[model samples]
Target chain A: MRAEHIKIGTSPPISFEVGSGECLAIDGPSGSGKTRLLRALADLDPFSGRVFFDGAEQSEMPGPAWRGAVRFVAAEPVWWTDTAREALPPDEACRSRAVRVAAAIGLPAAALDQPLQQLSTGERHRLSLARALADNPKVLLLDEPTSGLDPAAVALVEELIRYRLLSGNTVVLASHDAAFSKRLANARIALGKKPLTAHAP
Target chain B: MSYVALTYWDLVLASLLLLINGAISFGFRLNLERSLAISAVRMVLQLALIAVLLKFIFASDAFWPTLLFAMLMLAATGYEVASHQSRRISGWRGYALAGGPPFAAGLVTALFAVTAIIGAEPWYAPRFFLPILGMIVGNALAGAGLVLDTIADGANRERQVIETRLALGQSRFVAMSDIMRRSVRAGMLPIMSMMATAGIVAIPGMMTGQILAGAEPGDAAKYQIMILFLIAGATGLAVLSAACGSVLLMTDERHRLRLERLQSNGSP
Candidate 1:
């Protein structure tokens, strides 16, 4: 995944590239455009720049197809429907993989059938990541993915990120955890209030 | 058949009924007296003027003047539609969104009824054309207004849910399909209820007018049914067009939910 001169909202223009199988972390304080940056990468927000995945420009592909390839997991995830299962796209492969990943995240298979209102903040966070991963996207954009998780849950999620990295999936993650960035990301960028600067990996 | 017209004395006695209603409102402290009085006055004046002008129009047999009057009525209805919305969409967007569909749909349906359904001699004759056109335009205006109000409320209430769908790779059409369906249904509800209760529970105004004009009861019933069908058709077309057009205005070419395009006062 690659972003060339990507400027989102009022933040400064940023340019970066992550090779296949690489993990990049966006580190910033609150209200520093971390969420906006991730949203721009996912094509969920209007931005002035170009994004390319696997030699295909985002504008070249249809919006649905492009979004499917590069999925976004919001910070405060919104589950529009009543159940976790309904929030997922109806693809046989994605459904099977989602069930497996739910179990891997320490959730039972029955969790998918449970009502969304029953899930705690931590559970909702995990389910949001699982929903995005279900599609097996080429580039996964995550904003504060482990914000509300327990230590054990955080470790489990980090392990899942490692697994995806090993499988050659490109990931762009936003968080305020410097240690977490060192632990998972090979490239790092810290965004400030007025401007942003990319740090060497 | 000849019918007796109400004399000036009969009309004077009818004014007593309005005075009685106004007195009742005042005694009850219902706060409706002022509005009731104002509306009564406006109704008398407007209807009197229309009756006089319509007689002249029917005698003149000129197409342009009649068409011009119909357009004036359509413009007023559109203005009323926009004003009724709680979240006002102003400027040309407001006018086009609220007015365009009803005008187009009502005109087409009215023309079809006069020419094909009734086969009125000289289809543009003001006597038949204006009345039928009034009925279609009035119903369609209300339906289209309901559609616009529903969409405005839905857009405000369902912002996050809609954005979720859009972000999940759903097309703009697919993302808003549920809300659009609900809005169209809501717009059609009043007409549907009227249709359901037409004969048994209530007598519609058109039928009452025809009867009062000395038409045969059976023939008046037939004409009422025809007008009711035309209203349903025109409202359907108007509501459909209004919902679809408003939805398009809320999104962009990138399939992003452009909620910013929606006017908001920054409250939840």
Candidate 2:
């Protein structure tokens, strides 16, 4: 997955590329554009740039088709359905894949039967990841997927990301958690709360 | 039911309540003090002017002045409703889209209910149409205003979610499906529920008024039922119209919420 010079607000555009099946972790403090960068690649945030999904450019394909192929998990992903079971894709293979993902992320199997409102924030985050995994996406964009989790939960999420990478899913994760970044990222990009300073004197 | 006259005490009590509300609102946040004062003055002036004009309207043999007054009221109310709601759209186009459908539906529905449904003798008579249209227009205005505000607020606040959909390759309409459902539901649910529970909860205003005027209970009930149907129809049309208005703002013919038009409030 590649995003070339994504522009937001008035910030000088920055671009980065991640090799297929590799993991690139982005870390920044609150208000930094880490999430924004994920969104731009996902096409949620408007920017003047290019995004490449495999060899195909995002510009050529229909936006919905593009979105389906490249999945994004929000920091606090909004669940529209009643329960975890309802959130998964309709395919049987997808459903089983989601179950495995959930288990690896430390979500109990019974969580699927419960209403979304019953899940804790960490549980909800994992459920979102489970949904993304079920879709069989080529590239996964995750935003603060482990921010609200405890150490054990974070470890589980790390394990799940590692598993996805091993299975040949390209990953782009945005977070402020240094511990998670150090463990997960093949390459690290440090960003600032505000645009980096440049001077003309 | 107890009969209460519009006596001096009633007027005093209403005024006192309004004043108390103002005082409390001011105490908590004086951010709107100047605007509030201007609104208070406008209300006093407008009502005072209307009271003075009513005497001349009723006493005069000619009906043109009275009709003219009603038209002015309709236009003012329509403008206020449209302008207040479509701040994001922010122009005459917004005003037209916001006010046009509701006004049309409310006017037509009000006429149908007042004339054919309730069997009023002179359907076009301003005396009947004016008051009934006021109520219909008021509801339409509220309904349109509610839907637009909800949709815009929903889009702006949950921008990340919306943008995520857009990015993932959903066209504007496809992407907005979940949000559209939520916004419309939030706006329209109350009106529908009120209609469902009308007589059981409390006698509606029109029915109670007709009963007070010594109309037969059956006739009053019929009239109230007609009003309910008209309101429901107007609200339904309003929901459709508000959605149509918003569709233009968000997307091109392809039905994509234009990336530029979608403001990012907390998107990052």
Candidate 3:
């Protein structure tokens, strides 16, 4: 996946490229357009410049098709359905994969059957990550993917992401967790009040 | 028996009843007297003007004049529908989105009713066509405005949920289907309730007017029922179309949620 001179909202033009099995950490303080940058990459927000996935331009494919291959999981999770199970894509394979990811991320199987409104903030966040991972897109844009998780759950999330990386899926994430970034990200970009900079870790 | 004509003095006497509302406002210090008086005056002037215009159209009894009057009413209905929206698309697009569906639906429904059902001698006769078009279009305007309002407000409130679905690769239509369904339901609810309770809860205005004008009760009841059905049909079509149009306007071909396109009334 690659973006060249992408400008989102009032932010400066950003450009980056990540190969298969690589993780790009977008390091930035709060309110530094980290989420906006992630949104641009996902094509959820309008941005200038070109994005290419596997030699296919973002605009060349339909929005949903492009998004399906490059999925985005927001920091603050949102559920449109009543129960966790219903919130999955309503397909057999996705549901089964969601269950597997849920168990791996320390979420009980019973939690999937319970009403999402009854879940804790951290639990909902984990479910959202599980939902994204179940799709198993070529590229994942995660914004604050582990903000409210416990240390144990956070470790489990890291493990799951590491597994994804091993399987050759690219990831771009924004995180305040320095240790988490250090552990996962092979390349990094820093966005702040100062001009943006990118470097290999 | 022929209908009795009301004198000017009779209308003046009837309007005197508004003083009771003015009295209540004064007694409670509600400060509503000014608005109430202005509304009363405006209603009287508007209705009197319409009465004169209708008399002229009926006297002329020509197709072009009647068609022109119907078009004028439709334009006015469109304006009213757009004005009622809280958060509307800006410029001519806002008015077109609010008014276009209802105009098309209402015209089609009224034409079908007049030509096929009622069998009016001249399909565009002022007597039958004008009144049927007026009622259908009026009800459709209400329904379209309501559905547009609900969809706009719902989109704003559920931005995150909608964006999540979009990010999950759901098409824009699929992402917004739930809200569109709810908004269509909201728009249709009023007509459904009215149809359900028409004869039992209250005598409908058209039926009451027909009875006062000395039409047989049975015939008046039949016309009222037919009119109610036409209203329901037109309202349903208008609302469904309005929801689809609103969803299209709210999102783009790129399938991005463009909430910035909507602006609250009275804001820059």
**Which candidate has the top score in lDDT?**
3
DockQ (C-alpha based) per candidate is 0.55, 0.26, 0.82
Residue pairs that clash (backbone atoms under 3 angstroms), model 3: none
TM-score on B-chain, cand. 1:
0.92
A90: Cα error in model 1, Å? 2.6
Per-candidate clashes, comma-separated: 0, 8, 0
Candidate 3 residue lDDT tens string, A1-201:
999998754567889999999999998777788888888888888878889999999988899999999988999999999888887887888888999999999999899988988899999999998888677788989898889999999999999999999999999989999999889999998775544459744
| lDDT of model number 2 | 0.73
- Model 1: per-residue Cα lDDT over B1-268, one tens digit each: 7566989799888888988888888899888888998998899899999999899999998998898889888788778887777764656687778888888888899899989988987889899899988888889889988888788788778887777677677888888887899899998998899899998897899898888889998999999999989999999999999999878877778787776666642333
Candidate 3 C-alpha lDDT tens digits along B1-268:
8799899999999989999999999999999999999999999899989889999998888999998998788678778888878899878888888878888888899999989998987888788888888898889888999999999999999999999999999999999999999999999999999999998999999999999999999999999999999999999999999999999999999899999999888642
Clashing pairs in 2: A43-B167, A44-B163, A63-B169, A64-B169, A64-B170, A67-B168, B172-B256, B250-B257
TM-score of chain A of 2: 0.90
lDDT of 3 at B115: 95
- lDDT tens string, model 2, B1-268? 5454677677767767667657877899856757776887799788788767766765563558756866776577557766565344655666666677677777788778767765655565555666676777777677777777777877776666666455444578766777677766766776788788988999888898988877888988987776677777887787677776776686554333553553323322
**Candidates in descending TM-score order:** 3, 1, 2
**Each model's fraction of native contacts:** 0.52, 0.48, 0.91
Model 1 clash pairs? Answer: none
